[model samples]
Target chain A: MKRGTLKSRLAPVALLAGLLLALPGAPLRAAELDAEQQARYQTLINELRCLVCQNQTIADSNAPLAADLRQQVETQIRAGRSDAEIKRYLTDRYGDFVLYRPPFKAKTWLLWGGPFVVLLIALGVALRFVRARRAAPAATAVDAAALRQVLADEAGDDARRPPENRS
Target chain B: MRLRYLVPALVLIGLVVLFAVGLRHDPREVPSPLIGKPAPAFSLAVLGAPQQTYTLADLKGRPVLVNFFASWCAACRVEHPFLMQLAAQGVEIVGVDYKDTDADGADWLARHGNPYRTVIADPQGAMGLDWGVYGAPETFVLDTAGTIVYKQIGPLSEAVWRERVAPLLQGAKP
Candidate 1:
């Protein structure tokens, strides 16, 4: 019985090990580049948005299109294309949507400055709230004495009342 | 209402309106910047006809409809008949067989009537990449000057052809 339980437990682990072993090893490295070329290639891919997988950069995406684009970027880099030139080439074909950081233009003004505008508006509101809170105490300070008098009068009335009336 | 509160309320309304408008349109339908710009230059050999080459220069001086297709793409099959109909209507359609095997592309064209004036074999999708074709069945309408005037990202329906493409072709000098 002990042997049976041990075998059952080992079976899953063995299967898991087998599955892990079956998985393809490290990704294939197709290109040999110097450190500078590698760095530039990395930066370019990181900056480029994968059109197929909208959320991921080309470097991070596993989509076939992303792989093709990575190859294209590598080729462009090897061909001594400037980063700007490479970006311009991609933008010309895929439009500005393929860029992670879109250029500042007339149409993109809202996209670029929208957050700051919202932040400023939020700060203005917050400032107004703080000012209102600060000003509120000043207005209530005059009523403090009157409120104390009212409380004292109530206490005196309570003392004068019979036990049954208090009840 | 106080002006202070009114301004925020107005801003909120404006934001809501903007979001509503944004929501109405499909985000995937990004307008191509190539529209109104000159078509990308490419010189590819005609599929199955290695001797004949189709260059962008050949497309100049005449309006052309460039259609990207693949045998593996189901949508391409769906649009094949319409493309044939357009070809029958005297539309000069150029085909880009994207990333497809030569044999399969030839067989596909044979099975489906070849509606293209010349089908360029883009086995590695090099030309398709230059043309910015994300998916198959993308069609572009170029004016006589080889300027891309209109682009349809999906399969071309009769309605789209009659409404959008026909008008553009009519405006172009035959």
Candidate 2:
């Protein structure tokens, strides 16, 4: 179905979280260092999203496909593939959706940049509001009757005074 | 003053429009990256008939529909009859039973009335990985050149067959 495609990739909040997770890190030992390789396994699985369960990472999902993908990831890790290479393997088949952390690419520019854009707009509006407040004095409402009373009192005072003084 | 209210209101409208449009989409249905690329290479024996085999290279001369199904997948059952209908109409379909035992797959097809021209077994689903299959009941349509023209993530209903797949098979836009 050629449904009208309107992606509400509105959550740059999630993107920010994913960004921290996706940041490049040190290389792993080639299938030998058991402890660090296991650590790397944990990190890789956590970062890779399960396509079947959309929200859950492969580490977290019980879906058969997720399990299979997890196995694939582990196999590749033991083969000494780098994290980026492993991610590339998935993104090749599944597109960028398999990564919990989306890559900074053409399609995802809005997703990564949307929060900062909103922040800038908000900051611009606040700056304009602050400058406007600083530039103008508060216009207090002047009651018409109070203005008339003041005028009448001044006039009466003028009448009571001598002609030269009034002039 | 009105513009101040109007700005937020416009932003709210934009959000509503976006979410409303988003609601119509099936999020689970991931569009395959394999589309517009050649179908993945594989050679697996037909489900019941192990002596015979099918491969991606063999499917090159004409348009074909490659469907991945399994005995365990309930969604595949829903689309089985329509697939049979297509088969009756001489639509060349290659059925790959993803992560299914040959015994169960053959029995399922026999009971359900085999719709496939040839049925292949993918007990481990390694070929599923190659084809970018995340779930069962995924279908891929290949052009005469064997390039994957389109991929249907879920069930292939008659409406989808008529509206989308049929036209594309004829080299026209749906």
Candidate 3:
């Protein structure tokens, strides 16, 4: 019984190890980012798109351009540049197209606000649906007998009600 | 039933929009900084034909296509026929041999039936970096004023040359 529990616990760990082993390609070489810098850089890279590949973010891509961008980010971090400054520098060199989360200005409002606008419309439709469903019962007539019984039950539940009111 | 049809219709519209955005992107027309800028000057000698030298100064009066290639490059081989076609169309072509031996460049040219008017050797790739060449077989089209108007990063196809380069030769601004 004890062995069974141990086997069940070890099974997932073994399975995970096997899966990692089955994956092709060697692991990426880890750069020297401290805990604070690592989190910051990770967040930054996730936001920045790889210029060459365009579709993939620098954090997710293994292209040479992505690697160069990663190194540039690390170097910038070590030099004490803020995230905003770094992003600005990259955008200046590679255009607004390089950014995955494009800036909120004249041209990119459509990209930024499109999803929220869609979500708001969806919410409005859902609310209307629920409201219409709630009003559906009102459109149908209630049974008189059932309504009377409900009223009687309510009257009986009150401590001030007499036995005649229970009916 | 109406909502079901509406869902599919919405999905279809979304898919169409997605496809439209995907296909709308013109990767080939990504503007080069070299556009409207003067071609970098170089007076390198043609490797095999030692007597012939190529320079930006010489190509000042007419449209010239500077094609950077290497004998060892596979993409350059793919573009060989297109280069020949361009030559057949009476396009003046200059070649920059990137990091290749003189004998190999000459033999490769001999085998490929040399399409270039002049070929210069850049065995160290110094000139290549100066011209912002990350890889081989990049072609730059220079106008009469010696300004680089178009830069194609990969092997140029006959269709691509006709679509992108030929118009520029006919006096298109970019």
- Cα deviation at B48, candidate 2, in Å, is 1.7
Cα miss at B132, model 1 (Å)? 1.5
How do the candidates rank by DockQ, highest first?
A: 1, 2, 3
How far is B50's C-alpha from truth in model 1 (Å)? 2.0
Q: Best candidate per lDDT, number?
A: 1
User: DockQ for all models, in order?
Assistant: 0.56, 0.55, 0.11
Each candidate structure's TM-score, on Cα atoms with residue i matched to residue i, is: 0.82, 0.79, 0.58
Better of 2 and 3 by lDDT: 2
Across B45-69, the per-residue lDDT of candidate 1 in tens digits comes to: 8999888888999988989999999
Mark the 10 consecutive residues where model 1 chain B has the least summed lDDT: B165-174
Better of 1 and 2 by TM-score: 1
Candidate 2 residues A70-143, lDDT tens each? Answer: 78888888888998999988888999999888989999999999999999999999999999989898778999
**Model 1 pairs in collision:** none
Candidate achieving higher TM-score, 1 or 3: 1
TM-score of chain A of each: 0.68, 0.62, 0.56
lDDT accuracy of residue B24 in candidate 3: 89
Chain B TM-score, structure 2 = 0.94
Clashing pairs in 3: none
| Candidate 3 residue-wise lDDT, A68-153, digit = tens | 67777777877889999888767644557667877799978978898999999899989988998987755568889978877766
Docking class of 3: incorrect
State which candidate has the highest TM-score: 1
